[model samples]
Target chain A: MRVFAALVRQGMKVMLAYQWENYMGLVGNFAFLLLFSALWSALLRGDPEAQARMLSYVFIGQLLQNWTFTPTWELAGRFRMGDVALELAKPLSLPVRVLGDFLGRNIVRVLRALPAFAAVGFLMGIRLPDWPQFGFFLLSAGLAWVINASLYVGITLISLWTTYFDQAHQILDFLEGVFSGFYVPLWYMPPALAAIATYTPFPGMFFTPAAIFSGGLQGAEALSALAVQALWAGGSLLILYGIWLGGVRKMTVMGG
Target chain B: MLHALRCYLLLVGAQARAQMQYRFNFFAQVFSMIATYMGQFIALSWLTDRFGSISGWKLEEVILFYALAILAWGFAVSLFFHLVSFEDQIREGLFDRALVRPLNPFVQLLAGQSPIAGTGQLVFSIAAFLWATGRAGVVWTPLKLLYLLGVAVGSALILGAALVTVSALGFFTRRTYTFYWSLVFPARQLVHYPLNIYSQVVQWLLTVGLPFAFINYYPAHVLLDRAADLPWPLLAYLTPLVGVVAFAAAYGLWCLGLRSYVGAGS
Candidate 1:
């Protein structure tokens, strides 16, 4: 915990230096929200219930997405530069330290997105979730962080072996977005695609939380969703650990 | 011009072999690229499935918009990566190195990088274009066939010009990534849907100010034999001419921006 706190403090300083990027992200988010709101409102014209639910789904789904966003673009360079070795040489264990870094970055992102989400939500008529749902949302959100971090960091760690995935990265990014229900809620997806999305752990990232918050999944269904998310979270961490063992061995053999 | 074309081919050919050395990497890249490039089209299908059509444009018609845009953008990006990624070049000081060359920096930069990442996108676009042609029930004629090829080349030029124009801002500004995103994002995102969904003001803004419409929307409409909102439908045939003019204007901007560039001192 102490190590995590220290890392978070250090990460915040790094984040502060490049704060303008977050500001621009906020602007971009608002623009997309405005346009999507207009598009959905027009697309689902007669079905007001579905439309309202969708607006909330998009709003909260995208807001939470802002928190757990893991960038793949820099994976090739940062890992290739021997930075991973420096992190490994630290006194603490690596996965924990990386989690600390991930957590801290997300803290900054979530903080930046709050006002933007609030303004957009209010303007777009987002009904505030009840207290119970809000509490559950926080829980689901924590699990979501685990799922997203493990999945993305595991993929990023693959750069140790093959330092180039520029094209793969683009494809993975798109697949992740669509599968995670970030682009559209899985409910609205074609029946086959939606079913396929359910079987994948990716939906634990955004859709699970979005559904829980919007009360789309409730009571027994919500508990089952949380259980599924926990399953993915645990599964991802294990895979990440396994990948790290292999990657570390490769890195040492390469004499980096 | 012939010499420049030869140099571009030589540079790209050399790197293409190196990139192909890892067969596994090549296949993974191509497969992943197809998936990534399919995102917008997938969304278009899903939306069209639900809504029947978007603002009077049928699924096939909307797919036409998507396939053409991606095809052109892919070609532009693959061919003119230096321009598409100009901000990165500036940051890494490569743009300065290009400037110091005796040859035109534009040509030097264009000839330097060969990115095969867009190959999958181009292939996917072709597949989508054919599928859309079948679904949209458009009859083909020799002129239409000729027009399609012209539009592809013309749209590629227009997209390349836009990329160069935005990247030129890098010469005069410290950070132009957001501006690049601002320009490119709206073009790719909003342009996928029919122009009629947007307000008259936005339609006008896209048509005249940016002329992004000419890249795919106008040309696709003209080819599909759909009635467009343009006052003179004949203006549709002027796409290639418009593309040449846009590229020339953007090239002029590049020259102006070049004059202002004080190299990022080593």
Candidate 2:
């Protein structure tokens, strides 16, 4: 825990150094949210029946999409530079190290997202529920972080086998863009497509939690969604551990 | 020029052979790319079903635009893969090696690295193009076929030029990929719907300013017998010409950027 804390501190320092870039990214995120709001405002102008639901879903979806997509560039670079071995040599376990780094980065993201979210809500007239719902939002967000971190670590392990990890990253981006309802609403999808998405782990990272925040899912359904998310997190961790072991065993450190 | 062409072809061939050496990985990449594209196709299909059309264009017309855009994007990705990393290369002093080479620096830089994975996108786009065109019921004349080929090539050049221009900014600002993303994200949206749906300012920005419309929308509008709002129909026919100008400008800017490049290290 101490080691993880230290690593997180280090991550925070690195993040702070890029404060300007993070500010720019925050503004960009807000801009995109505004763009979506404008498009949807144009879309639902005459259709008051679906307006609230659509706005809520779009806002939450954007939040989840922005938050859950992991930046694997640093991990990929570390692997390529053979620094991942040094990380493994540390006292901290692999998952802990990965989670610590991601958690630290996401802490910076959360801070950055706060102002952006406020600006978006102000501009788009989006209002959130009170503290109780916000608590559930926090819980679901924590799960999202875990899921994202696990997937990043798992995907980065593929670097050991192939140098073309960028292709994998692109594929992951496309999948998240689609399955996580980034561009389009999942409800608008064909029943078969939506059914497949429900079975996949992609939605648990973004759509399920987003639905909760947007009030699309509630009561027993929300609990069931959380349960599925827990299962995914556990499954991902297990798969990551397996991959890390195999990757370490097969590791060939080249070109120091 | 012939030697340059031959060398480039040989380099691409070698890249393909190298990729084939890892057959399992190659197949996995292909399958994954196909799956990724399937998601986009499904989304677009759903949107068409709900909205029927965007602006004045039908679903098939929109699909045709998407097909052309993807085809051009695939070509750029395959051919100019190295150009995409030009910023990184400059930042890391990789350009110095290219500068020392006997061949033209642009050729050397372009042919140095290849993306074998992009062949999957290229093949997929071709399939999508054929399917969309067949369904659109457009009669293909020889002239129209020539125009289509020209549009594809022009689109690739325009996109490549845009990439190069963004990459050239690395010489001035080491961290320019963020700006690149801003440009690319918006440009990606242009390939999906007709420019008329956007505000007049955006239409002007996409057409006269960025000139991306010449790559597909303008030529496509003419090809489909749609009424073009541009003053001169000859402008629509000048897709390849527009590409040449853009590429030349980008090349000139690249040279200027190279002059400013402070090579990172030995």
Candidate 1 segments exceeding 4 Å error: A164-171, A252-256, B1-6, B21-24, B82-84, B115-117, B181-183, B228-235
Q: Highest lDDT: give the candidate number.
A: 1
Q: Ten consecutive residues with minimal summed lDDT in candidate 1 chain B?
A: B179-188
lDDT of 2 by residue, A1-256 (tens): 7888987877667777777666656545654554455445545656765666667767766666556646678778888888877867777666677677667776776676677677766676677856666666667777876777787678777897778776676677678768766666667677788788876777777777777777776778777777877888888888788888898788777753
Q: Please give the lDDT score at residue A218 for candidate 1.
A: 77
Off by over 4 Å in 2: A20-45, A160-174, A249-256, B1-24, B115-117, B228-235
Clashes of 2: 0
lDDT tens digits, residues A113-147, model 1?
Answer: 89868886888779978988888888999999998
Candidate 1 positional error at A16, Å? 1.5
Model 1 Cα shift for residue A57 (angstroms)? 1.9
**Residue-by-residue lDDT tens digits, candidate 1, B61-127:** 9898888787787788677645656777787776777766666777776666556756777788889
Among all candidates shown, the one with the greatest TM-score: 1
Spell out the clash pairs found in candidate 2: none
